[model samples]
Target: MKRHAVPAGAMLAFFLTLTGWPQCASAATPDGAALSALWGLPFAGVLLSIAVFPLIAPAFWHHHFGKVAAAWALAFLVPFAFFFGANVAFGTLVHALLEEYVPFIVLLTALYTVAGGICVRGNLQGTPRLNTGILALGTLIASIMGTTGAAMLLIRPLLRANGNRQHVVHVVVFFIFLVANAGGSLSPLGDPPLFLGFLQGVSFFWTTVHLALPMLFVCVVLLGGFYALDSYYFYRREEARSRFVESTPDSASFGIDGTVNFVLLAAVIALVLMSGLWKPGVEFDVFGTHVALQNVVRDVALIAVTLLSLVLTPRAARAGNDFNWAPIEEVAKLFAGIFVTIAPVIVILRAGEGGAFAGIVHLVNTPSGEPHDAMYFWATGLLSSFLDNAPTYLVFFNLAGGEAQKLMTTGATTLAAISAGAVFMGANSYIGNAPNFMVKAIAESRGVRMPSFFAYLGWSSAVLLPLFVVTGWLFF
Candidate 1:
């Protein structure tokens, strides 16, 4: 597939401007304490555009989304430069790029590229049982291969299996809810927020031990609900069901092409782990942001893995998967704006009781000045629904007193609540997590008729909100 020139060129320009800028003598970053909540309007504006524009003006949104994103980003940056000085504004932009957006987009691009090359071949009917099995399998692998990797690898086959169905939108929706979000709750490798925790000194298996029950509870409920819903639809579409059955070949069997891509997936995971574990005590400062040697190695190695998959995988496998670059391209451009606009919001959140959002800070603490576990769950989850979950997780992580050992032991409940909230609630919106949008884009490109952004919010609120409430009552 041909690359989209606009986003690629925009990203290149962003990186060059970030790295090539001169640093200020004083390391004056945006002081969250000095900022007001009004500073967050641009971030909120961008998020609203993401939610509203597609439904009201599909053509305009599709054609000019990059420009919209950039406009919102500049809405924040221009004011920020005027108020905070160009040096501080540039520093903030550079920090956001080097430390957050770059690594994020790189990992996503690699996973999307590699997973797109592996196609599942065979004619399979989308029976409730079969669909449930695919969801279960995708959920099981999400933590191992990441939500992005697992979603990209399996979505095409799942779509193909259900191609003959009259009612298939629910299948893709549940896939996003389960495989693309909740499934990633078990390990740091499973979700970006958890991986950020790992980088912040949380143990590799801490989430596995802490969040297993909550994750299992949510998955079981979702899977059971999906089965009942799918079975109902399957019965109603008797004509479509017969067509699917007739098209199926008795001798057809399932097999995976480009199996070698699995090895590259493993390499991707290893590179992530290595970046967290193999710190070489070396660093490079890009503007005011510090770039570590190990992270550099990890990013480079991931790029190499992306190249290797492109070289080794047969073109036929990708063609069968109907792979294209649009999903990744959309993610890279939109999140560039997200990461940029989100900077002030994060700074304000980090400011805690002294910041303009002090009321939010107060809500997460008890009358006794103790961490409120349920509130932590809800607050983190709510913020994570709109903002990127990784930084939201980091905000609550630090708010809960950023001591890894203490959190693992004495503050275990708080940490688990934070982890569960960030990972689970990411399904609440398409833009909550990276994989959610990519999954939606892929499904829509294949004619799945995905729900508009607000409609999806309605789905998650109806389906997932009750589950989260139950989980909080039982565990948090």
Candidate 2:
């Protein structure tokens, strides 16, 4: 034990050095109000890299995307550390990792792991009705087990069921629209943004009550659109379809395997709920960023659950599901760069009327300072489409007075609009939500030709934009 201690200490030192941990106690963030829009170039570069590299250099991106992400992160960090001092850079880095990115990736990884363990074993085939049914079911449970969990659990089976289809991109796109984004609008547990609202004193049921109508509206529209589109393609395929052999045995029937993972999934949900509900009033400061005790416990316990699922899950279940770490790995690597690069953007947004995006902040208000529910929906949504929806939700939440009670009562409409935008518009792009990318990656790995980033944007713009306009006019 004593001999191992020295090597462990050395490894810890190496890690701290590698991560550039702050050596000073003072942890200062950038002054968002003083910063220029030029600081956002790296973020733009990251987005462009994600959007373009796949099209022009698919092999390069497949191999060196992580390096590209690291390069962009350093593009921000090197300049930031040089201008703002290492203390500030390291401070913000610690804050982003410990407070935001770590917990986020941890939760996602846990969901991916546990869901991977539970394979729906049996013979299944994709018809328009069956596909729509699966989408509807996933959307319904998304609010219960989270979009990430439900997406991970159901995407594989859906892909397998439709493995024979040549034109299945629209199916995955609608999956993103419904199961990955719009479906999560009904509860805090369903999405990150609403959960942030919950932490800010918004009642747990507030979203469920206010956003239910908008959720149903968008989901019904998207699902119906998907059914029509799928039916058209299905019938079209039938006219010239191949006589492909059925993959599964006829004796097999539809049923679930790895039942224990359902319990593990419940445990995951319980841990998340507990972190939000249990207030231990304890915290640890890592380089001036305060880390709460309950969150720490929750993240740690989630890691344990991830490991437990791996160990306890039946081998056949995972094998049948074709579960691998590639999708989660893609998400983890890409989002690390995203979270880091978006740090300055979040700070600037947090600065409100004084920040670089003052016009954006002001867009949510009327001339008389009253909250504009329509603008709130569009603003929060448009930004959320390009930014992390959780912090985007927080930015607008604070912009709208940051008072949960008032937002729930007097500003209820505004709050509802904000919630609806953050959750629903996350379907607008592949990078809009974590699950969107994960779903895309999983679908692509399973041989589905997902749309490119801009193509997906085109799909959402065509499918979702008009509905949002209607929703805003009708409800906001």
Best by lDDT: 1
C-alpha lDDT of residue 310 in model 2? 96
Instruction: List the RMSD of every prediction in angstroms.
Output: 6.0, 5.2
- Tens-digit lDDT track of model 2 for 28-133: 8878898887777887787778767887998999999889988988999899988888778877777777777788778878888998898996777778898999
Model 1 lDDT tens row, 1-476: 23222222244445555776333433467678999999889888887887788879989999899999999999999998888777688778888887878887788788888889899888787888999999999999999988998999899889888876778899999999999999999887788889778766798889999999999999999999999998888886655545656233445587889989989988998888788777667766555577777877988999999999999999889998888887788878888888788788778877878888888778999877799999999999998898768767877887887778899999999999999999999999987888998899889888899988888989999999999999999999
- Model 1 TM-score, 2 decimals: 0.90
Whole-model lDDT per candidate: 0.85, 0.82
Q: How far is candidate 1 from the true structure (C-alpha RMSD, Å)?
A: 6.0
Question: For model 1, what is the error of residue 462's alpha carbon versus the real structure, in angstroms, after optimal superposition?
Answer: 2.5
